[model samples]
Target: MRVARTLTAGLLAAGALFTVSGAAVADAPAGTKGQNGDPTEAGTSFRTATAVKQDQKATADGTTGDYLYWQFPAGAGQRPTAKATVKLPEASARHGAATWQLDVFDGLRRRQACAEGEQTKRVSQQDATVTLSCTLRAVRPYAERWSNDPLPGAYYIRLTVADGPDQDMGLPVHAEVEATAEDAGGKYAEGGELGAPLHAGAVSEPEDGWNGSWWSDRWLWTVGGAVLGALAAIGGYTLTRRPRRA
Candidate 1:
C-alpha cells in the first residue's frame, strides 16, 4: 500500500512537470528567429536612421544625392501607415539621383532586400525642405515588414544602398532619422506609445546542445521517478528484514 502511494505521488509530480514545461514552450514566439527563447517582458523599440548609419554626402558624379537606409527586424516588420520623411541638407547638384531605399534586413542575418524603388530622391522644393516622404506600402514585400516580426530586443539596421550613378559611384551616404519619441500624442515614432528604446534581449536561434528543450524537461521528471522508486524498494527490504522482539 505504501509503495502504491509513493508511485502515485511520483506520477503526480511528473504530470505537474510536464504541465509547466508545456506552458513555457507554448508561450515562446512563433517564427524562425525565436526558437532559442526570450524573456517574458522583452519588446521592440524604434531607432532613427542616423542612429543606425551616419555621414551624409552627395556623390562626385553630380547625378546622385545624399540618402540613408536601414533594415527592419524580421517577423516584426511593419508597413508605414503614413508618410514620413527625414530632413536632408543641401548637397552638390544631383538632378534626380537623390533618393531613399527603405529595405528590410534578412532575418537576424547580415543580408538585406532592396524591395523598394531602385532610384529614389526627394522632390525639388521651393524652400529648404530637409525631409523626404517614405511610403511604406510602396516598397516591395510590404506584407513582410519589420513591424510584423516583433523581436524582443536590440537588432541592427544597415544602410544597404543610396541613390547614385549606375556604376563606380559607391560613395558613402549620410542621413538622420527623425525621432518620434515624446510626441504630442504621448507616443513615440516606433508606433509604441511607451517610447521604449530598442532593447537587446531578442530571442534568436538556439545554440549548441540546447535543442532538446521540451524533451529535456520530460527526461528530468522521468529520472526523478526512477530514483524515488529505487529508494522505496530499499526501505521496504529493510523493514521486512528487521528483527522482532519476543
Candidate 2:
C-alpha cells in the first residue's frame, strides 16, 4: 500500500513537469574563446584581425588611415557590445573634420546591426579623440541562411576613418577596444541550435565548456519542490496513522 502511494505521487509530479515544460529547449553554450591579455596589435583585415578578451580592454597603436580590426566570441542568449576610442596624433596634424566609423560583423562575415550607440562620428580637426560603440541584437541559437538574425559565433569589430583630411593619413594614433556580452536570458532557446558554433580562421573554443543550457532554472526548482512535498506528505501520513485494532 505504501509503495502504491509513492507511485501515485511520482505520477502526479511527472504530469506537472510535462504540463509546464513546452518542449525540448536549449542554448548554444554560454561564453566563447578569448585572447585574454592576447594582443596589443589590431588586424588590418579579416584575414589578420586580432582577438580581444570579452570583458577587458585591449589597446593598439596605428596610423590615422589604418583599418583596425578586432574579434571576440559570443554565444546564444547574449547581447554583445563593442566600444572603441581613438586618440588622434595632434589637432595640428589634421586638416578638416574627419569621420570615424565602427562596424561589427558575424563569423559568416555578414554585417550585424547595432541596437544602439553612435557607430560613426565626424570629429573636427581640433577634436582630440573619437569614441564609438555598438550594441548587437541578442544572439540566437539558430537561424536560417536566408535570415539575418544574430547567431552564436566569433564577432568582428572594425574601426577606421570613413572620411578624413589627406594630411591625417599617416599620423600615429592610439586605439583602445573592448567587447562585452550580457546574458539576454533564455528566450532564444526555442529557436533550435546550430550544428556547430561558427568559427572563422584560427579561432578555437575557450575554457568554458560547451554544453546544453537549461530552458529555465525555475523549472528545476519547481520540480524539486514538488518532489519534496510528496515525500513529506507520505511521511506525515505514515507517522500520524493510529494503531489498527487486532
Candidate 3:
C-alpha cells in the first residue's frame, strides 16, 4: 500500500510539473527576453544542474578543472544546441596550454553526439578564452531502446577541462553557456503516413509540434524489418527444397 501511494504521488507530481511547464512555455513567445535577470551560477552534477531556459545566457565562476553543469528543457521536433566559453585566468599565471571540452547529455544522462560545432578545443596559455559548441540531433517523440535516440526532456550541459597544466588546475575561471533549439516541423518519409507510429505514450512537446501526428521513423523501421523477414523466409524455403527429378 505504501509503495502504491508513493508511485501515485510521484506520477501526480510529474504531471503537474509537465502541465505547468507546458503552460508557461505556451504563454511565452519564442525568442522573447526572459522576465527575470540572467542566471549567474551553475551546478556541479546532473541532479543539481542549474535550470536554464532557451537563449538565456548563463554565467558562473569555478576552478579550472571543476565540471560545471547546467540543464535546459527540450521537446520533440526541436534540434537543440549548447554553446559555452571558458575565460581563463591571466595568461601570465599559466604555465602551459590547456584543452577544454563541452558535453551535452539527454535526460537519461546519455552523452549526445554533436552533429556540428567544435565540442573540444586546445588553447595555448596565451589564449584568454576557449570557445566550445555542441549541436545535438533533433529530439523525437519516441524511439526504440536500441536506437538510443534523443527524446524530449531535460538536457544537461557540462563544461570541464579535458587537459591542463598542474598550475591551471585550481585557477579561477568564468564561463558563459547557453542552449537553443530550432523549430523543425515534424517531417515524414514517402511511404510512412503522417503519423504511422502513433505516439502511444505521453511526452513533452515543442511550441510548434504536430502533437496529434507524432509518428514516423518507428513505422519506417517496422516496414523495413517486415521486408527483410519476407526475403529471408523465401531464401530459407528455396534452400530447403530439393530440385524435382524426373
Global lDDT of each candidate: 0.32, 0.78, 0.76
What is the alpha-carbon RMSD of candidate 3 to the true structure? 14.0
Clash-forming residue pairs, model 2: none
Q: Which candidate is the best by lDDT?
A: 2
lDDT of 2 by residue, 16-56 (tens): 88766633211112122337644677777876677765786
Look at candidate 3 and tell me the lDDT of residue 222.
83
Query: In what order do the candidates fall by TM-score, top score first?
Result: 2, 3, 1
Give the least accurate 10-residue stretch of model 3, judged by summed lDDT. 188-197
Query: What is the Å distance of residue 96 in model 1 from its true position?
Result: 3.3
Better of 1 and 3 by lDDT: 3
The Cα error of candidate 1 at residue 62, in Å, is 16
List all candidate RMSDs to the true structure: 28.2, 23.3, 14.0
Q: lDDT, candidate 3, residue 107? A: 70
In candidate 3, what are the lDDT values of residues 79-120, reduced to their tens digit? Answer: 888999888899999999989999998777888899989999
Specify the poorest-scoring 10-residue window by lDDT in model 2.
24-33
Q: Per-residue alpha-carbon lDDT of model 1 for 50-157, expressed as tens digits? A: 121011121111112322323222112222211123333343533233444433333344233333333234344222323332322211112233454323222333
Hey, what RMSD does candidate 2 come out at?
23.3
Model 2 regions lying over 4 Å from their true place: 1-38, 204-246
Report lDDT (Cα) of residue 110, candidate 3. Answer: 84
